[model samples]
Structure formats: structure tokens, C-alpha cells
Target: MSLGAFFLICAMPLLSGCAGFGGNEAPPPRPIVTAPPIAVQPPPAAQQPTGVARDPSKFFTPAQMAGRPLIRVAILLPFNSPRADIRSLSNALYNAAQLALFEFNNPDILLMPKATGSAMLAQKAAQDAIREGADLILGPLFAEEVGAIAPIAHASNVPVVAFSSDTKVAGNGVYLLSFPPDEDVNRIVDFAVLRSMTKFAALYPQDDYGNRVRASFEKAVADHGSQIVTSASYPPNTEGMNLPVQRVASYGGRHGALLAKRSELKKAGDAAGLKAIENSDTLGDLGYQAIFVPEGGTRLRALAPLLPYYDVDPRKVKFLGTGLWDDPSLAREPALEGGWFPAPPPEAHAQFVERYRRVYGAEPPRIASLAYDGVSLAVALSAHAEGERFTTEALTHPDGFAGVDGIFRFLPDGRTERGLAVLEMHPTGAIVIDPAPVSFGVPPAL
Candidate 1:
């Protein structure tokens, strides 16, 4: 199975670091969203960066290193895996990091190749990266690998910036860099609530990814004081899809009997009756103005029509989805029309895109830029601090950093507070019909 498909079945358990924050009641009072300063744009082309400015903490702060010493960064990835896509993604991320380093006087970042397609190989690679004197460890990519390496990294006190979102496996110095599935639902729920979507219905896969998304969506809905009229889970397959779609779409308390009613229709009348029944089973009403779908785009395409089938007009009901909905195929899917989700919109990184293409001979993928930002930001912190300890003070500085992606600053919990744009998949194969209001400040300190 593809890594994306497999991630659905086996996901790493998340470790919650509540930081003694209060109960899940209302999220603490949020700062007003305002227009970011125009300087939020990319760095000026003419402004010659001092080496210290390249990574401020690395030089400026008493705790971080200065002058771009050979930053021995070790990239840990599942390179030997059968899934070439993830391998390619890893390569892209590595290339992006390298490019970032080159801009900062080309530090001595190394890729510690591992034979991690199998369980045994992953262990060997994890040990090897540490042995090689890695200052900052990039990844072991998968959740299982992260779990295996967490203790080792903790023991070594080598800061690991990971690609996996499974926070449970992330050790003290390990910072998860992958977009959390819960954050996806949170953004959608927040947007829907802003637009006044009071009732919600969800149909998701019967797996961990789906479960994580469902839990987040449920919590968001409840937190917003909205009701979830119907929520169901189905196996991530075609046959498993139609039933739930029919159930959630069915009108007037006749959710489970669509198939039975179809059987009762005479052969001559069945064709016409099936059409009518399908239509009846598909449409939702005014009260159900939002649908949260956490499944991947392929399955959602098949299920999308069922939204209209139940009477939920795609135009009327605000469709919410996960970060996986960023797939380009979503544009071609008729059911995804009017859908919105939170993601690092590529348009925001125009300069990064051009530069990456110039360097890598291809457009940078989502995670590639993210990994680049992680390394670049780390270097920035290292430069700013002018020491090797990498204190928390170095990380949360508000000098307003810029990278291949847009401006972002670090939060206390090691999560990046980035400005995410809410993009819509238009019928014309375009996205980002309406952008969310950008928050200029650091995201509530995590």
C-alpha cells in the first residue's frame, strides 16, 4: 500500500503536553486577527544578510552557535521503502534543507542513509545517525521509527526535528513537523463556525486517521455549541463508502432502508425508482449546513455526489476537510466543489517555488518546504543565540522570521505558528477562493 494509504491504518499515538493548560473548555481568548504588515513579504532581494541574521540565535544569543560552523545536520528517512513517493518526498525535503544551508554558507549537513524499508533497518539507521555526531537530526519519517528512536535521541540529548506528527513518540528534544490531522479539523470547524454552520454531519474512514479527525471534529463542534446530527465511520473502500453516504443523505428518518426499498421496486419501475431513491438519499437540508470529511480525496470523490444526493446543496453546505484534501486531484472531483481546508498554500511561496525549481529541477512539495523551514529556522535560532545549547528563549523570539514559506515564529510547545490560508477547490480547478484573516502575532504561545 502507498504510505498515505497505510498511514490511515497504523498511526502513531499522540502524547498530549498540556503544559498545565486549563480544561478543553473554551480555547483561551484569541487575539483579534488583523492584516499582517506588508513586510511579511519575502526578504528584500538587495538586503545582504549578515551571517548572524541568517540564523540569529546561532550567533546572537549566548546559548546558540555563531558564524555558521559546519552544522552537522543528519537527515533520517525511510529511503529504502517500496513507496517511491515518500522517498521522493524525503529527497525533496533533503534538497530543500541543503539549499537553505547553502544560502547560509553551506553547512556540513549529511544524509545518514538507512535500510529502513524493514523494521531491522530502521534501528540500524537511528543508531548510525547519532554515531556520526549529528547536531540536529531531521527524521526517521515514519511513526514506528520515531517511537524507536525517541529514547535514543533523548539519551543523546540531540535535538530531533521530526516529520512524523505522532507526538507520543517525540522525545523531549524531538519536535514533530508534520501537519497534525486534528489541526486540519480545527481550522475547518473554526471557519465553519465563523460562517455560522450550526449543524454538522461527518463520514470518515474506520481507521486511526479517520478516528483522529472525527474526535477533533466532534470536539470542535461541541466546543462551538453546535450539534452533530449524524456521524458515522466506514472502511476505506468503495463498497464501504456508498452505505454511509446513503445513510447520512437519506431524508425524513428513512436512513437505513434505501437498499431494502430499492429491492421492493418492480423491475420495470426499478430504474426510475432507483434514481428517485438515490436522489432522496443524497440531499441534506438547511439545518445541516456543514459536512466534515476527513478521508483522502479519492474516496471523497466517490462520496461527494452523495452529499447532493441527500439534499445538502454543495453550494449551501460549507464542506470541511483535512490537509490531505490539498491533493491536486481534488480539483477534478465534482464532489469537492465548494470544499475548504487549511494548508500551506503554494502561492504564498512564490519565491520559494522559483528558487526550489531552479535548484531541484522540480517544484517543491509541501513537506519539502516545511523541512526546509525547520532547518532554516533552527539555524536562525542557532545564529541568534550564538551558542550550542539551543535554549527555549532562542526558539520563541518574535523578531518575525521569514523562510521559503511565509513568515512564522515558534511557540513554546515546539509547534510552528504559521499563517494558514483556507483554500477552496473551485469547479474551474482553482483554489484559495477566499483567504482566512492572517494572525500577525505568535499563535497564542502554543
Candidate 2:
């Protein structure tokens, strides 16, 4: 089948009336239909069958299953987490998964929600799901919880599409569906290199996320035959950012050069040179064409202005970032006005957000798409013959699967590679400078 046809087939079952398929021609407009919200309720206690095993059928009514062959998909989340924020996120994820289930209209698939408020609980939940004959498993949002369930899922040969971004717990039957930092780094660096940016610098936080982005950034620059002129890491706080930003900006060296230039101009008694140096605090370029600021939110706002303050002119030096810069508020930061970042194509995500709002009456968190895609993928794959469905070969298909986030495929190592677009920050909004590729191996139009 053609890529477009394959995507239309896989995506039609999940999307509302095939709304967001990729092609040159726009899909015809359809009447807006508000789907009934899936109820968010506590799962009833599981009833054990005649022997030691638990009956997964007990989790659903006969009418919902409708006498079809069962495909139990266990979704483990921290529904009872001590933290309110975690609880809310868990609920949202579950709701998204439920939305996918209804939209796909798959009667054979039974979604099982299990609480994983702690690592111990997560392990037990995995045990229960396996014992209950879960054909596939979906979540357990944190890395620690994923670790707790990986061995159990591997032992049972049950494939898990998890939501955690940590690659440490991914592999051997556990695949992460969440966005990885490497994707953002690779996409942005590839676009920057294509745009003739060779010399690079970075200012990243001195934490796990920073370390991951730094490693990816270095590898990407080297892979593209570019060089890192300078980089610095600092604590992710307002107070700890100044020194690192200044260091990356090369303030001391440039300031010393400015002083030397002023002295030379005075000795020569050149009025034009003196006047040119008068308003500038630093002299000479930072020797980098682009600088990576892989930060977001308050930290980004705090860290951005420091570059211009230390004479790293944004006009001359392009500011690059990861997906963290997807925030619209970042447009207000003059330092990021011309910055470039990689993110999922916004048009599809915007449509998804609108549908989610219409159904659930609130804005879904950005990561909520992970759950929707995971369930949609499962439903799409379930159409395969019994033995072939949910296997490594089927799940790792090179063509990948179309998702709300974009086209993504599972790597053998259990990491997901997604098609991302290069977006430029503008005062009005972020605009796509380069579109995301619709299929693997085909490059996006520049």
C-alpha cells in the first residue's frame, strides 16, 4: 500500500471522521461532532476466577465486550498518587485512552485501569494485569514505576507502551511512547546545520535533563560536521544562571578585547573607531553562529536576557532550542524572537486540543497525546491476525504509525523516533519553517 493509504487506514479508526490525515490536498470539512465525555471513575475490585488466576472479563460488562474475542489492555497509572498534580495527570491520561477506545469503536478491546501510587504498587499491578491475561499494557507514567513493571512484562512476553521519557527503562518488551529529548535535539540540530550554522554554543541546566540534552547535542553537532565553540551548565534556578550564561557568552574575553580596541583607537586618534567602540561593552564575535538554550518556563525567561546583557547579540547569533520552546509565551522574550525549535506539527495538535476541550470541557495537558496515541496504536494493530498482533515485528514496523503527535515508530531498543517540524519563534506566534516529514526516509520540503 502507498504511505498515504496506509496512514489513512491506520488513522481512520481513531480520528474523528478522518480529520487529520496528511496529504497535499486538504480533507473536506465535516460537521463538528462533540463526543460524550468518558466517565472518570474508580475501578471496581477485580473478581478472581475459579482458580488462582483473575478473570479480566470481570472488569467489563458483557454488553461492552459483546461476545467478541478479548484484547485486554492494562493501563497502570498513579490514580491515587499522594501528589494532587500527579493524580490529575493520571486521570487525564486515562481519559485520553478512554477517548481513543470509544473513537476507534473497538468492541473486542477491554481497557483495564490499575493504580500505581508507588513502585511496590506498580509491581503488584503488573502482576495482576499479567495474571488477568492482559494482551497489552499501556502505562505507569514514572521511570521508577516502569522499572518495577519491566521485568514482569518481559517475563510474560507482554508488550508495554509506556509514557515515561526515560530511556533507561526502555527495551526488552518495554517501549516508551513519550517524547524523548534526543528527538528534539536531533531535529533542531539537523535544521540548524541545513541552514548553514556550523559553530555552536549551549547553556543548559546542571541536572539529568540537561545532561541528556548535552549528550544528544554534542552527538548531533558532530554528526552534522559542526563544532561546539563553547557550552556551559548551571543549576536550574534564577540565581545560578547568570554566571553560566555569561561564560557561554564569552563576556570576559570579549570585554578585554573591547578595552584593547579602545586603547588602540585612542593611540591612533581615530575619531570614527572611537565613536564605533563607544556604545559597545564587548568586542569581537563569540565565534559561534548558533547557541542552544534547552530550557523552558521561568528558567528560560530568566536565562534568555542574560545573553544580550553579556553581548551575545541575538541578531548575529541564532538562538536554538529543543521542544521546550514550544510555549507561546516565549514569543514575548525578545531574545527568543528569532529562535528556532523543533516540535510536533501544530495544526494537528491544535485540532486535537479543540476536540479534547469539546469532549472533556478543559484543556488537556500537552503530554496527554501520548496516551491517546498509545491506545490508538493498539487499536490499529489489533486488526492483524491473532498471533501477529502486538509482536515486536509488527510494533516495530519501519513505516511506523500515524499519531496525533505525528508519524512515529518504535526502535528495537524500545525508544520511539518521531517526525518533527522546525518552528521559528515570531512575535505573533511560532511558524513552521520546515514541515515534518509524512513518512520515514522522505525528507520534508525545505
Candidate 3:
């Protein structure tokens, strides 16, 4: 099938079923199309523009406004960010949004791309978008940028569906669509608790992400009637990890106890006690039944093995993680095998990745799905009556919208609650052990 036709078929369910929501009820599940394989070559470097091009003509064409009522949705991003990585992310987000628009075939929705490389620039972008009669704003992908534009968008009463994971900027008409660590922590902890794991520990980094996850982890454990027996904080990098890992394992105390026991056995002439202590490095049970490791990538690799190395045996104490542990490569780490983490269901996301690769000829960043879903949401809501398309009430429907990442809905406070699945790490890859719910209303507890 043609690529355009495939997307059109995939988009029908969302466009038709997402129009109306009465009262505070869950919406019916919308069917999603799984695209077949398509052959396409990769795009060249020139196709990925690094420099900012604010030309209005690039996004808005005369043919798009063929007498239909327009819904201006402005997307503010760091198109000219000094950091090349940020700039590339901005381009990917823009491309994803454009792809969503094209797939849904929403001609009346004019996507206005604005550069927000700095707070001042983001404020100006917000002003320009509001001046251009934008009904809704999509992003300014940083916390500072979101803060800069919040008042302007609020004054204009243009609702913003931003992409920042920081919950601090997620209120007063600014909804965050990005994946917050709280959701991951809550889901995994809930799953652990359901499986009868009571006491827990954590090994986290000393950074903003770590702090956020730590807070969520504590609350989740407490709410599930479980206790946090111990936790250790380490530097964000590989350095300074040994002390913290050892601390969590109580290595010094446990080893000291082992030596003391061995000496006592020798003095008392108890051969069995001596034999038990002869080979054992530690002599005490861990206080916790499970340990939460919220680090990922290199830091995760460095941190995970230390637990087992320090005698916090994975067989005795479960290893838990947040969405940061969603990497398939982490499965190769022996310490992470049988470890569990929470993430969005992979079925629809796999299809999204395939489609994106076919079209863009590159792997879309993990967060790129946010832009596609944000645009899909705007398109779905555009089918509503004029002046009611982007209201807070309309946006916060209890029955959330289904997207490539699965089911998600915005709260009145602007925080997004997502349906996450629990996955176990195996030598081959991560496998979904618990499926994500198709609809909302399920409590986090068993």
C-alpha cells in the first residue's frame, strides 16, 4: 500500500471516534492500524536542517486555506538552539508534527512553527503565535522556556500542550505531554507491591531527574503499605558510585559481622559455624526485599553490578527501575536480567518507529512521539465546534486520547497520566510482563 494511504487508514479511528465526550467517562478504545513493511532509503545529512528557517511559507500554503475555518496551532521549539543535539531534537519534533498533520489531512489546522532557543525568544514566539490567532500552543521544550511563555499564553487564553517533563511548569493552561518519572515509579512500585514485595531500597543519582524519581519512589512505596528500608545517592556520572552502592548493600557492617562471627566460631570450636563463615563475605540479610535503580545508560551499567558485587544478591532482593531502564541493551547486563521496569506498551510504538524510519530515514528520538501525539490531539479536538475546540474542559476529558505511546489524559492541573506496562529484562530483550490498560479508571493499587 502507498505510504499516504497507510497513514490515512491509521488515522480514521482517531478522527472519527475522538470528537465528543459527555460527562466524565472513559472513551471507547479506538482501533490503531499496524502498518506493513515499506522499502525506503535513508535521507541525506542535508535533509536534516541545523539552522533555523522561520519562513512562514514553509509551513503555510495558500492551498491549505481553501475556505475552511482555520485552527492555528503554534509549535514553539529550539530550532536554533546553540546545542546541536537540542537543534536536532527540535527538527525531529517539527517533522513529527508535520507528519501527524499530513496523515490526519487536517487542512484547516495551520501549524505555525516558532523558534524558542531562549526564554526571551520563547516569550516573543508566544506573542507572535497569539497575535497570529493561535487557538492552542504545542511546545517550548524546556522548563525555562515554558515558564517564559506561560503568562503570555494564559493572558491570551491559548492552552499549551508542552513537552517538558518538569511538572513545575504544568499548570494554568500549560499541560505537559512528556513522560514524567513519577508515572514510571508509581507503575513499577505498584506492580512490585502486587507481587508481595514489601520493603524496598533505592540507588539514585544526585541530579534533578534523580531527585524527582526519589520523591515519587518514596511516596509510591509508602502508599502501597511498603517501607523504604534504605536508599543511597551517587553522582550522576560513573564516579563516586562505589561508596553509595556499598552503602546500600551495608557492606562494611555486614562484612564486619561476618568476620566477628568467624572469630567467635574459632574460639568456641564450632566447626559448622566456621565453615558457614569461611566462604561468606557478608553475614546479614538485606533490610529490603527490592531495590529501585532509577539510573540509565552508562550510569546504570556502572551502578547495577555493584549491588550484586557488594553481596546484595539479585536472587534474594528484586531489582526495580523506572522508564529509564527501558533500553533493550540493558538486558545484556547480568545484574539486570529478570529486573522489572515500567514503560508504555511497545506494540503501537513499534509501528510508529517503523513508519517514522520509513519516512524520515532515521530513528526518531524517544520523545518525538510526544509531538506526534500532541498534533494528533489537536486535530482530534479541531472537529469540535468553534470557540470550544481548545478549552480546558475539552482538553481534560476523563476519557483520554489514544496515541502512538498508548492511552494518556491530561489532568486539570496540567499533569499527564499515562497507561504504562511493566516489562522484564531478559538476555534477548525486554518483555512486557504486565500489559498497559486499554482505558482509564484503574487504580494504581491491586
Candidate 4:
């Protein structure tokens, strides 16, 4: 079997271009009915991509087609890597994309799969796809790999739909389909701003991921006309969490005030009044009304109990978070209960999980759905203008595309904004405080 330089290539070549694609057709009037905001149920398995080879009249209308090329797609992934550890992840992603294309089952579209093991190898594979005349490309999972192949794809005027979660490597003809931390931070913090939270503080870990979350938190807070009053970072561990937690809670001032007030009452010899307040921790209010803890999983559990011990009570200071707080395990910690954050609607993903488990015979990672959504979106776009499907104009559709993680769209700048719901932590799990909207036609009311 001939590989498309990247993957198994079809012997057939398409003759369609995006030029005559409905150019002369009149634009339809704006629809009175809106598309569903988010699709919880996956698209039916029998669905097909649009523009399956007909009499060429569909895209060209007989007059325009004259002779154009059909759309060709190249899928790039680290299928054979030196690192054996990530083989499962890469295969899962590849399988998801394959599923999307399989479900599409469009005869008009031509596909190529490119496998790369390193940055240099990815560049070689990408060049092969371009040589094969691929109109669109999908994936190269890591940031460095995306960085390596993006220029090659761009040189060929082909847009890449990459699955890298890192947003820094995005843009210039590459679209990252992975969930970036900015989306989670922006959604949750905006919800906080909507709820009238003014002052924010953070107890973040001293690491790259923590820094990214903190940066996103800061930007979100500033954009909302709020401010971060304090931020403290600690090395990852239970060993040194006390210092950072104390600094974030402002233990010195709070405890100092308590001691001073207690001294004042003692000097006056009002033993009864002193007794009434001696057992209390609060003597002065914390500067921030909300504290954003971006920690997740076991690390979050370690940090949570430290807050109340430092005289910082969640009862007073609202606990805020990103998707990191979505873990059901966090609910076991009483301090995390009632904490608020943003995440995709769970019901939609629940359906996907069941479906995927049935097919794969194992539970797929959450990110596997991202791969499916990316390929599925490409199929949807191919219906309109196959060759020009990856245009900036087409990709940044304001209404966005509904995927396994609800609805998301690419911004003109290439940042992805997802329609997310605010969830509150309960002993049972993270429950939706506000349901995600059906469409982002209107921004959520502040």
C-alpha cells in the first residue's frame, strides 16, 4: 500500500478546488432558528461528510468546475516513536481521527497518514504530505513537533489542525485542538467576576504548569477589572506547602491582629470578653474575597486542609479554580466542597465514554475525543469548500463547532474559546451550577 508520504495514500487523486465553491450563489438569509449550542449526543455513526463526489454540479454547478481538484487530507501523528510510553496516547488519538473519517465515509475526500518519531522526522513526513498535494493536515501532538512542521505546512499554504494543548505554538496556519489552560481560567474567573468577586489571590505550585495557570488567572482577573491581591508558590510536595499557604492567607497579619486585640482585652482585665474571643481565629479580614487554587488531584488534597489551619476559611473566602478542580476525588475533602470552577458539560462526555468503551474495549482518554472532534469538524467543513476548508475565515466561525467537549471555536488569533458551564463541588461530585448554553450567539450575562 502506498503511504501518502505520511500515511497510507489512495491511488486516486481529487480534481476539486475551492475557487468556484458557491462563489456566484446568492447568500441565504440569516436563519431564524439557531444551531444547538452544544451537542451532547455524538453524531450518528452513519453520517457522511458533505460534497461526496457527485456530478461535480454540487460544488461547481457545471459552469465553475471547468476542472478543479478534489480535497485531500493528511493526518500526522507520532505513530512510531522511540518513546514507547506515549504509543498508547498516539494510537488513541490516531484511532479517534480514524473513527471520525470512518463515520464520515465520504468518497470524495482523499486521506494520507504521516508517521514521525522526532522533530526532524516530523518535518520529513510533513514535506511528504505537501508533495502528495494534501490540502489540509491534522496533528503532530507535541508543541515542538507542531513547531517543526508548522512552517513546512505553511510554506505549502496548507493549514494544520494540531492537537497540541500548548497555545504558544499555535497560529500561522496551525490550529490547536487541545484544551488550553486559558479557557478554563477565563471561564471560571469570568464566572467569579459575574458573581461580583473583586479581589483574588492564588496558592499555586512553583512549576511550568502552575505558572501557565497563574498567568492565565492573572490575565483573566485583569481583563474582568478585578485584581490578584496575593499569590504564593511552593515547590510540589506536602513538605514545603506550609510557608506558601501561610503567605497566601496572610497569616502574620491575621494572627497578629488577633494577638493585639487579645492583649487589649487582657490589659483591661475583661476576662469574660477575652474568653469570648480567645478561641476565634479571625481578628482581621483577609484582603482577598476569593482565593484561586490551581492545584489538582492528590496535590490539591494536600493543600486544601492547610488553608483552614492557617486561619483561612473557605466559609469566608470563596475557593476558585480551573478545570483542575473538576476531579470527583476532590469532593472528598470537605474544604473543597462548594468550590467553584468551569468545565464542559459532563452528560455529553458521559455518552462519548460509553460509546468509546464499547468500540475500543477500553476507556479512552478524555483527549481522544478532541481528535475525533477535529477530524469531524474537517468533514463538516469539507461539505462547503473542500479545498478552502481550512481558511481562517471558515475556521473562525463565530457560532463554533459542537464537539465531545461541548461547543468551541477558534479565535481570529488562534486561541480557542469553549462554551463552558460553572460547576460547584459537592460531596458527590462537581455539579453544574449553570448549564452551558446551546450557542455562543450571546455571551453569558455578567
Q: Pick the candidate with the highest TM-score.
A: 2
Per lDDT, what order, best first? 2, 3, 4, 1
Residue 80 C-alpha lDDT in model 2 = 68
For candidate 1, the lDDT comes to 0.60
- Give a tens-digit lDDT track for model 1, residues 1-446: 42212211221110011122346644223222222111122222322111111232331211233343544566676666678897677667667766656544424333233335444455555555556555567776788877666666666656677777765665466666667776667777887888878899888788878777777788988999999988777887777776787666655445446545776775557787777766455222455778788866567777777667666677777778877887777788776777888876555355555556755568887667766666665555444323543554554444334554444544556555555667888767547755643334423443
Position 27, candidate 4: lDDT:
29
Give the range where candidate 1 is weakest over 10 consecutive residues by summed lDDT.
10-19
Runs with alpha carbons beyond 4 Å of true place in candidate 1 = 1-68, 107-115, 118-120, 251-286, 385-389, 396-402, 407-417, 433-446
Q: What is the lDDT of residue 247 in candidate 2?
A: 90
**Largest lDDT belongs to which candidate?**
2
TM-scores of all predicted structures: 0.72, 0.87, 0.84, 0.77
Worst 10 residues of 3 by lDDT: 42-51
lDDT of residue 219 for candidate 4: 88
What TM-score quantifies how close candidate 1 is to the native fold? Answer: 0.72
Q: After superposition, how far is residue 160 of candidate 1 from its true place, in Å?
A: 0.8
Q: Residue 116 of model 1: what lDDT? A: 50
Give the range of the ten consecutive residues with the poorest summed lDDT in model 4: 6-15
